[model samples]
Target: MDENCDYIFKGYTPNFTLQEDDIRAIQALYGGKPSKSFSSPLSNSIETYQAVSKQMAPSVKSSNKNSALCLDPQFDAIITIDDDTYIFKGI
Candidate 1:
């Protein structure tokens, strides 16, 4: 078992002994490609975030559009200030 291999998915802990096919299938069902650094905790978080963020972008965009300031819905917009921050106004 790889000492650095640490991942949690769907409420189940990952088995470090997982085969290549298992990893591929998991990636297909979820949304990440296997990486050599998959064994690293930081890499795992980054990959998980990337995968989930892609899945969330559409819905978040739509919600932002519909939830903008009512008086200036056309003018209001969601602004990404940075990776960790955003500016949005709601009615």
Candidate 2:
């Protein structure tokens, strides 16, 4: 475990190290820009930050995927194009 990490995301960590897509995923994950300062010494440049920020836009994911401990709870509504209603139980 990296002690210097502000947020340790182990979800995408390869379990058996045999996932063929691991390399691509690792690249995408680490290549992402860090806006805020991390505990580590890695300097996150503004360009990297912007690129990663673009991929992590709130509009990318639906409201149902919001975690319970969501730091930002303002995303409570989403417009439906087909008028189909779907109830989302609290995650």
Please give the CA lDDT of all the candidate structures.
0.54, 0.51
lDDT of model 1 at position 29: 93
> How far does residue 68 in candidate 1 sit from its true spot (Å)?
19
Q: What is the TM-score of each candidate against the true structure?
A: 0.23, 0.18
Worst 10 residues of 2 by lDDT: 68-77
Instruction: Report the C-alpha displacement of residue 89, candidate 2, in angstroms.
Output: 3.9
Clashing pairs in 2: none
lDDT of 2 by residue, 15-90 (tens): 5463558667877878755678666543456556666756665564456654433433234344444888633333
lDDT of 1 by residue, 49-73 (tens): 7677556554433445554343232
Task: Provide the global lDDT of candidate 1 against the true structure.
Answer: 0.54
Candidate 1 stretches greater than 4 Å from native: 1-39, 59-91
